[model samples]
Target: MAEKLSSSPPARNIFQRLPLLGTGGVVLTMAIAVMGIVQGLRTISPWLRIGNNQAKAEISTLVVQQIRAVSELTTTIFAMETVVPTSQERQWGNFTLGRTDLLYIGYGEVRAGIDLAEINEQSIQQQGETLIVTLPPPQILDQKIDVERSRIYHYDRGFLNLGPDTVPELQTLAQRQTLAKITAAACDQGILNQANQKAEVALASLLKNTGHRQVEIKTTNPTVCAIPSAQGLSRDKING
Candidate 1:
């Protein structure tokens, strides 16, 4: 009966009380800890996402620079032979004074391609893992007559030298005409289309080789083929 002799033992410390927490209590404690860690992560997730997006943006910029470094890409070549008949006539008021006739057999080439230097950051876009590149329109890059392969097949002064002695002039005219004709023919034969197709294929291969697994190439319609003519030459100067 001295001080009622209390039967209750001393209170357990946190470490000692942990063992009294049975399966359900232990599970609840773990859940609470997990939730706290998740909350901490959530607090910093926005910055993490921003950093990831920034890294991707930088990579896309570098890719754009790499593409623009390719400069000009020649994709297709059109070569053919043409026969051009050019003539000149001088008239004196209801009477033909003189005439010159020249037959030219010319071999020419037309080059069609894209100028990659025109590519800019705007031309390229990235979506997840794929890249979309919009290329410049295909155009006539170069056209020329092969001087060594071209020649004046025939020259006629027309009726006892009544025509002007303009061998060199007529040859020059024929060459200019040859270039125009070949360029027109090339355009008619789908040179621009060929350039576009080949360019797409070539770039796809190039991008794939550079570690791009998915790439889409887009092209623009070609401009009209230009027919070159002498600046001051008149219709009267060219009879044919």
Candidate 2:
């Protein structure tokens, strides 16, 4: 009738008419997601910091242990070199031969007494200055031998007798004994000198190996110092 009132389709619902409401809901979801991510990062940050601190402490402890170990090794080596003799001297033999006249022919033999004296460790320590070592006292070994002989010879109606003669033998023996004594003395002196040189070398090597150097302390309350690195500060090097 009245031109059918020219009616359009029934009015749309508010939910369908306002498309921006859907967009607003999507924005709110995105904001919530961003907030969740930020919270997760905050929760993990403290654990990462704690792990980093623990690693740094372990590294410092290891360095200190290495230094102490090296020091102890150096000390032990020095003691050994100072206390032990590099060379030793020993008496080999001593003997005498003689002829005597008791029967048709006779022979006698005599052996010289040997006395060995070793330089004590105390003496070595007193002479040395580089290191201290404990050493036992010197010991002496002695040996001696004695013999007698007589000989007689008969020719026609006369008898000839012989006795031991030891003057020339004693002179030669004395010369050999003096040479041996000189050799022993020389050996002792040489060994002591070698010990001192060895100690010097050990000390030098220890210093070099340990990188012995003066370090300036940056803080005293917590005992902190700057660690030298090829590239400025340690933090900068690590971060870069």
Candidate 3:
């Protein structure tokens, strides 16, 4: 019997080792791909952070612009004049004259009459609102006086007369009427001034209130990022 050579361990072949080597290589490649992905994420984080900061800055700028716009609108409204009629002609009624045979009676009747006192009084109750003065109906003041009378007759039937005995009373009434008109005008002016002051005060109060509310919102409910940035994560890790 021929002595059989101990069979050497089956020679390892490149083909047989290929699958193992390829698997190892694939694992290494996967590790490198993972590392590259991590690096890419690290690099993009800073750009994302910059973009977020820019967005925040843009939002802050828009907020400021809106606030300025509101402020400007408030100021314009405050400076605007009320539409109330200030002219005397528009406030007062029309005047008419009638002549009689013996005496001429000049009657001043206002088509519309405005009572400033009433307006002012109403303003006391309704603050911060404009009040318009409206005139009432025209008041009639009649004056009759004799024009010509004959003296030849003992009982002089014809005589120059101005009007009835109430002519003096009418004159006095006219004076009072004129004075009242002047007083009303002054009162109206005062009321308008007071209303404007109140409006300004209200506007200031509104601005202050709005600012305080915004501050409270900022302090009590602070904004926080839902997902922390990579930089923030690095900072936390370093701190830890």
Query: Which candidate ranks first by lDDT, i.e. highest?
Result: 1
Give the alpha carbon lDDT tens digit for every residue of 10-114 in model 2: 344564767888889999999999999999999998866765445444544543444345432211110010011111112235432223211122221111111
Q: Pick the candidate with the highest TM-score.
A: 1
Cα-based lDDT for every prediction? 0.79, 0.31, 0.30
Tell me, what's the RMSD of every candidate? 7.2, 23.7, 26.6
lDDT (Cα, tens digit) per residue for candidate 3, span 1-240: 233343333334656888999999999999999999999999988866665445444544543443345432111111111111110111123632221122212121111111122222212111122212121211111111111211111111122432133433333333333323433333333433333344344434433433223221110111221222212222111111
Clashes (N, CA, C under 3 Å) per candidate = 1, 8, 17
Better-scoring candidate (lDDT), 2 or 3: 2
State how far residue 116 of model 1 sits from its true place (Å): 0.6
lDDT score, candidate 2, position 228:
26
**lDDT value, candidate 2, whole model:** 0.31
Looking at model 2, which ten-residue stretch has the lowest summed lDDT? Answer: 76-85
TM-score of each: 0.73, 0.25, 0.27
User: What TM-score does candidate 3 reach?
Assistant: 0.27
Cα error of candidate 1 at position 64, Å:
2.8
